[model samples]
Target: MPERVVPGRPDGLITLGAADALWVDLTAGSAVPTAFGAFTRSPARARAGYVLLGGRAVTTVRASGGRWSVSVGEVRRAAAELNAVGTDPQDLVRIGPFHGAPWQEADEETVLCWRRRIAGGLWEPGRPQRAARRDLDRPYHLAGIDWRQMLVERTRDGTQRTWWLPRAVVRLLDAAEHAEAQWLQASQTHQAGAAVTGPPSHPRRAARDAGGRQATDPEGPAASLRPYNGELKGQLYSVLSRKPGTSRGVAGWACAVCRTAPAAVLDHCHEHGYVRAPVCQSCNTLERPDHLYSNDIRVANRYTRLFHTDTDDWLRHWHRCPGCRARTTLPLPHLAAWTAHTACRSLRPTHRAPRGRTPCGVLRVSWTGSQNTPRSCLLTVTVDCCPSGEHRLLAQVPYREAVERFRVWLAETAPAVAAAAGPDRLDGLPTEPRPVVADTSGEGLALF
Candidate 1:
């Protein structure tokens, strides 16, 4: 039988230029479990036999804000590397110079294509070099390499999307693929003998609880004991656990907003804890100011409608005022403006009307009750009016009792409101301004 392609070593950071050894990715190109070779190259002479893929030398310019930008050549070098791994490598000379200014600006086609290469919205520095280890029983190898290398394709719009992989990784990945095929064939033909891959006994089944149930320790050694699946659920789980707005999630296959660029990162509502959709960096960055600072409810709603899979809850609640029958926006939870909408106090003054309008209305809800007094929750509704003391008291009652009464009031008042209050009609509302993001990089900007 051919030599079994065993795991190289316990994976950790190893200096590439130092000692020579085999660095094998047990899962091939699937997940981030590439292991540093456990054993050094057998002989010093063997070092000469292996080829090393050299990285492009990157030159960085740090702006006054400490943001980094790379030369135009670096972008071309990345494009070249990505094309080299594709089925049809396009000519680097044929690809035109980037159109945007400062070399960091994101366009629809380029940003979308750029997001596919990056795991999150932002290009993580040194991510292309590091492979976090994932435990697997069988030493399975698949075709192609990991996210370290990417393939490039030309879009119909004449823009390019590409990801780069090193030649060294490509060679090792190809070798590991061959090794796996050989091992599988050997195990199939010789069933009577020991299998070529996988441990003698599964590590996850090794430990048991007092009740005779299988014990699991995801934070311990058992974290790495599970079987490998192609879906990358392990990495996704890690990403979901992080704080909101962290550009640590996987890249989207397509941007949900523009639908033109590939989504570069997972966009989320920091205030509402709503995990939105994978979107391009431009779309993701554009969402923040609109949701937080913009006074025009329609503009903010437009973004929410596009990026969020479901906008019914947002629309039905804060999007339209029940009293004034006008569309309005709400502030984040921590902002002082949010107090007007929550019944934490006996009574609070309503928010000043949005710029250039009268006090539209205020709809406040309060669920304040201890475990011993669950029924103490209350809902208070009020609308600010032009004359002081002329304010209308819509409702004040137990939270359970208030819902039915409020619905009755809303039903009666719905017909009299003007037809101009439709949420979808955004012809004359204020437009969101284009925001300039800080350009930061390590080696260089990956999305350029």
Candidate 2:
């Protein structure tokens, strides 16, 4: 006896008698086994047989006898192994107790009936068949499997039947079905010349049809020129061909006020619509129409008076008249008298007047620097005195030179005023005439 290896079960081997068995390697398509040679040569009695190796039916042959009949126990063992390896059930041959009948000889109806009976585990040799629901009799429910798209087909002889899908195989059948239906619908619509609802197929053509030209006109004085006719198109082309600076450039190349940032926009007076000059974006924003009435700008003007004219500058420096509260510009000599009057009026009535004379005049000297440039200063002198008038003087100079000139003026003026008033009149003054120098700490008017 010789042993042959089973196809699926590595531990199982089949024993064959020398005369009854012949080696037939199915994968290589060898000739019919010697055991089935007689049947293959004679067509009249030839019946299709199957060889089960390791429980999986591997090939068909023409043969007869107990030599090919696999026992129930062997069949069960083979099935268990096949199941463990996930073999397809269609690959298996029918298990039978019939006396050496070939599976190919069975009629279609009889084979189908047997298959139905065996598929539901209703057939067990020598054991009573149990009454159980057949697959057709009960609703088919397979875990993770959808049956709606399953397909079935039969072979040419009709003895063997197979399905396109396995019972346990799962797939996204619904999504595939929907996509197929959508494709069919789209094809039908296209054939019928109906418009499809989706993104445009030719975006450039669609944009042209939807008036894209009007939205993309280049901003310029001649931007209004449109190609309504050939003549207009020619004119527009000529205008566009000119050099860049010919029409768009401004005469002045820097902001009028700051004079730092490049002049990039043509600013115009909002009220009159007259071109002011080329100015940077920041300077133009400050002069917007809304800022004319803004309280913040008003407050800012109260301090610097830059928004208004030079007359506001004069009034701010004078501090107004004490008796009439009128805004006036006076010479530097009249400032002492104006200050004295204002200070005398401001004194509280409840407090007794100074026992001796008190000086009521005040003089202030300050300087402003140009924020855009270093070492630049605008020096201003303001004097406030009683019963005469107020005066202010302004000069532009270098920062360090301004400070030096102010220090020199303070040293000279303080003694001259005191000497002119004399010791007798000093008692009527608030204090001896003293010049005050404005300090950088922003504490206004400190007397020196």
Q: In candidate 1, which residue ranges exceed 4 Å CA deviation?
A: 1-276, 279-374, 384-389, 397-448
Q: Which ten residues in a row have the lowest lDDT in candidate 1?
A: 43-52
Distance from true position, residue 401, model 2, in Å?
A: 40
Q: Number of the top candidate by TM-score?
A: 1
Of the candidates shown, which would achieve the greatest lDDT relative to the real structure? 1
Tens digits of per-residue lDDT, candidate 2, 1-448, equal: 4344456532232323211133222211311111222112221111223222221222222113423222223333333433343323232221222233222221221112222323333333454322223443332221111122232333323443322332122112111122222223333554454345654322111122342211111121112222111111112212333548522333224344445343334443221122334444334333221111111111111222222233232222222111111112121212221222222223312222459554333433333432123265443434334324433322223434433443343334343322322223222222222222323221111110
Can you tell me which runs of candidate 2 are displaced by over 4 Å? 1-252, 288-448
Count of clashing pairs, candidate 2? 20
lDDT score, candidate 1:
0.29
lDDT per residue, candidate 1, 1-448, as tens digits? 2122234421221222222122342223322333222122211111211111111111222222432222233323322443353321221111111233222222222211112223232223465323224322323211212222332223322433323333233333322222222233333444433245543322112224333222221121112122212232112323564756443223323445454443445543332222345554444433332111121111222332322343333323232322112222222211112232322223544445556434334433222331123276443445543255656654455543443333343344332333424446544432431121212321122111
TM-score, one value per model: 0.22, 0.15
Q: Which pairs of residues collide in candidate 1?
A: 8-38, 112-261, 112-262, 149-164, 149-165, 150-163, 255-263
